[model samples]
Target: MNKSMNVFVIIALVMLSGCFPSNDLEKKQVHLTGITMGTVAYNIKYIEQPIDGGTPIPSDVVVHQNVERILKQLNQDMSNWIPDSELSKFNSHDSLSPVKISEGLRRVIAESIRLGHLSEGKLDVTIGPLINLWGFGPEARPEKAPTQEEIAQAQARTGIDNLMLEGNMLTKRIPNLYVDLSTIAKGYAVDLVAEYLDSISAHNYLVEIGGELRAKGFKHTGELWSVAIEKPVSTERAVHQIIIPKDNAIATSGDYRKYFEENGQRYSHIIDPDTGKPINHKLVSVTVIHPSSMTADGLSTAMMLMGPEKAYAFAEEHKIAAYLISKSENGFIEQFTVEFMPYLK
Candidate 1:
């Protein structure tokens, strides 16, 4: 497969069991699946049961419609590809003054800035220019690696320090700074869907967008939600580990896919903001489990950029539940933080 197709295959590694309940007393399962945010697929499963034992459970049509509406609104607010999206408008704005933004955009930008600080600018949203120059953003892919001068030009337009968020407004320190939230937006969408499910009394549900996911309560069989982490291999897909992420969100970032090889060297899409180039490290994948899918998503990317050793230290220091997989001469090496041990099945 080509590099782009390889990315889709690897991302499909997070498998879920769609088994339905057989017993009568067991809550009925409602599954909703659809495409959203470009090529990403979303799957939402929840138990259909009356909370008060009197009101009838919402029909499948109602739930599906509501979920789609929620996703559509989120995409409108955050999608950089959409010419009319709020983010796109902000990017096009040349003013250095603070520009008013919606509450949703404000929250996303604030969280991104916080993560940038936490990761010491490793997970920067302002690196869109570099990403585009490297043929990973909305721009068309280049036939070869970018030259040093081109990379330096893109790097000049990026820096976490160029972004500022205050209340419901965002300001750019420099007019040329471009921001992209593709790394964390999907995770935030998952969390938003989970919150919507909870608000509708859906205590037992699994929310997954792309490969990022959040699970709460239990399945119809009274068992916790099971998630599988994909083994990082280009030739074939396989499960590396299975875990019961009860009432938690899980996200994984890997470099085994979405990469191109030239002159016997590989260039991954996951760029290191420090060097303005693709990460060159033994670490293949990093998974994080947290209370918020948004946090897990951002942390996973940051940890992957740190590589195996630093990622392990960061996870331990911050008390983050994380799993790191690295490429080894013989095969692959697997490592998990102490906090992640409880979830392993």
Candidate 2:
């Protein structure tokens, strides 16, 4: 599957975004950058001063290797591109039987099911079949759009209810039920790296995988790190907002960049499970902030399924820090929940 099509958010990091004065940052900061999770680029940064005060710190080489190791293990367990990945194996399993999976796999699947259920089927990870039918997954773009019969057949294989988890054992109630965790996998990886850094007493750091990100503590400038949220536009990248993390992780979902058009009708890469087609609503973007990048990732995608009005009410009712943008006759309309006020620049 093309993992890049899973999300449309573009978050520009402050430290690297030229937000801070170049001559100001003189403190020792260890910045690590690499590509992982099948084309996702990430960079982790932390002040060496924090390690200086800790009991002992691993060498930079060890830290890099371990971080990449964690990412590699995660990919082996959950990535859809890896043919032998645990997730791919399970998807190929055409039996209604229980299969033992790794604890890490169980963790991500459990959260995905929970959020899928909570959102009332708005974010089903089991929508892989429909995704492929729409030519968004590993399959090539169909010569033409799928017929209703084809869509119904694929939709039958979806639904979070078809999946069940008993401890570390995950089961598929239907023989053809396929699961895909592309939506939330990067966020889980982000949290995993952050936890590992925390275990090493690296509190003052920022971790990002793809667009899902998390941060803690102040930067070398003795101030909290800020991140830029780009406006939802296909022409050019523009900063829509710059906000502090509030000691939380951030995830954004949008549909401007990934879509297909046919005969004047536009189809987004973000599928609506209810209809088994691309979302056609006016809500173009959704960004959420929470302590857990995984949760924020799930919520952002879930809110994208809900149009602007419903998403706004949902965020307010849940007291979630959400920023939503919708298309209008004049221009894009922006709305943020009260909880999101503190995050504004």
lDDT for position 184 in model 1: 94
Candidate 2, clashing residue pairs? none
Worst 10 residues of 2 by lDDT: 1-10
Per residue, candidate 2 scores C-alpha lDDT tens digits across 1-345 of 000122235555674332322345555678999999767899898766544456555766888999999999999999878899999999998988799999999999999999988888898999999889988887798877889999999999888999999999899999889888878988999999999888887777888888788998767776677888778888767667778875689999999877787878877888889999888888999999999999999999989988888888888888999988887776767888888887777
RMSD per candidate (Å) reads 4.9, 5.3
Candidate 1 stretches with Cα past 4 Å from truth are 1-25, 52-56
TM-scores of all candidate predictions against the true structure = 0.92, 0.92
Clashes of 1: 0
Q: Which parts of model 2 are misplaced by more than 4 Å?
A: 1-11, 15-26
Global lDDT scores for all candidate models: 0.85, 0.84
Query: Residue 14's C-alpha lDDT in candidate 2?
Result: 74
In candidate 1, list every pair of residues with a backbone clash.
Answer: none
Alpha carbon lDDT at 71, candidate 2: 96
